[model samples]
Target: MIRSIIHDEMFLSVPSEKAGKEHLQTVQDLRDTLHSVRERCAGMAANMIGVNKNIIAVTMPFGEMVMINPVIIRKAEPYETEEGCLSLKGQRKTTRYRKITVRWQNENMEVMKADFSGFTAQVIQHEIDHCAGIVI
Candidate 1:
């Protein structure tokens, strides 16, 4: 189910709750929504689709991935960059890490941890920020 992109700053500002196995459908929906907007967006959070759950979908060079309750365990090499969102107008300047290690759950609810770098890492960081209710 492709959901609508939420633009309400107040709603987007509120932090999302942790996702569980029961939230699997939300994960699918987030992926669907992300794919729907792939031409203009590279990633999306559950909150961006109006569901306040700690879920995010990102498009990588290989494929698309969904992260539930993602946490950034480590970050290295910070740099400034500007980003745009389907839920927000224009791009905003923010600091991002060139490399990041994250722990998150897959669609099956299994824990997965891995390191990401460059654009992929940046996209993950941005989506994680959405989960934390920080709209950059």
Candidate 2:
């Protein structure tokens, strides 16, 4: 049986120095129980990616990042956008990279990299920032 994750817990704290550690743990926990966790984190099934939910519903699992230690390789123009988190009850304004390329260690501890743009870029940056212990 798959179960959803508790979304509210993620938004409960400010991303302190331990945000990266905490986010990593959260991702791991999700991966460990992904079936239910994904369902719970995802508010919409097969919906286009947007700022509707705090969780990023990746359309493709291939190269799906579980950022354990994510670092931005490049950054583009700053843009303000409407965003929402499962942890946060309503939508809020946030700034994110218009473009970003990042590298992170996977669960296997292998170095992996990706480049993202538009909404996908935003989601990755947002989640990675959570891992880095930063909040908007």
Candidate 3:
């Protein structure tokens, strides 16, 4: 289902819980919601749709990818940039890494890890921040 974008700062500030196999539906919802807003948004976290699960959907060059319980294991080369969120009023300045290595689960609940950089990496870092309850 395509869920509504949450704008409540208090709600968005609370950290999301780890996702499990049972949260598969939330993953689908994230994908659906992300696709629905693809024109203006490149990524979305589960909390953005009002679900407090550590799940995020990102639009890659090939297609949309969902990351469950994503964790940034390593990051390098930080730089400052501004970003806008569908759940927020305007863009905010923040520091982001040029490269990041993440460990997460796929839709099937299988573990996956990979390195990402440039814009893709920046988008992942932003979504992960949502999981951590950090608004930037």
Candidate 4:
């Protein structure tokens, strides 16, 4: 049997006391969305782009990372270079960032921390922005 490649899990909205219907689904949607996010994050890993406000956001299996309420822990001096993303299609441009530390909770309610440098750092920032509902 062919395995499913769809993800529909949605993260919880901020301030649990005031969560809306989208944040309180029946569960299946949540699982699917989360799965899709991971897959997109992983598959798009090779194609992630550097930080560029002018550049379009990267595309993913579930549309986009669409992360909600994300925050950056630390950042290092930035360097400049061209960048690309799977979502950006066949394009590249100069981006900046030296090294950065990131922390964020996933749809599964787990905290993840990682150190990123060069291209990876930019990708993480891009993805985190996606998680926080940033399109660019």
**Top candidate by lDDT:** 3
Write the residue-wise lDDT of candidate 1 on 27-68 in tens digits: 889888888888889999999999999999999766679999
Query: Candidate 3: where is the Cα deviation over 4 Å?
Result: none
Between the candidate structures 3 and 4, which one is better when assessed by lDDT? 3
lDDT of 4 at 11: 23
- Determine which window of 10 residues in candidate 1 has minimal summed lDDT: 60-69
Q: Kindly list the per-residue Cα lDDT of model 3 for residues 1-136, writing each as its tens digit.
A: 9998999999999999999999999999999999999989999999999999999999987878999999999999999999998899889999999999999999888899999999999999999999999987
- Compute the lDDT for candidate 1: 0.92
What's model 4's lDDT at 123?
65
What are the lDDT figures for the candidates, one per model?
A: 0.92, 0.49, 0.94, 0.40
Cα RMSD of all models vs. native, in order, equals 0.8, 7.2, 0.7, 10.2
Candidate 1 residue 23 Cα shift, in angstroms, is: 0.6
- TM-score of structure candidate 2: 0.61
The residue-by-residue lDDT of candidate 4 on 1-136, one tens digit each, is: 1123222222211111211224423123323433455543332211122111111122344543422233568887866655433344444554456788766444463566666676556765655544443333
Off by over 4 Å in 1: none
Residue 32 displacement in candidate 1 (angstroms): 0.7
Clashes of each: 0, 4, 0, 17
- TM-score for every candidate vs. truth? 0.97, 0.61, 0.98, 0.43
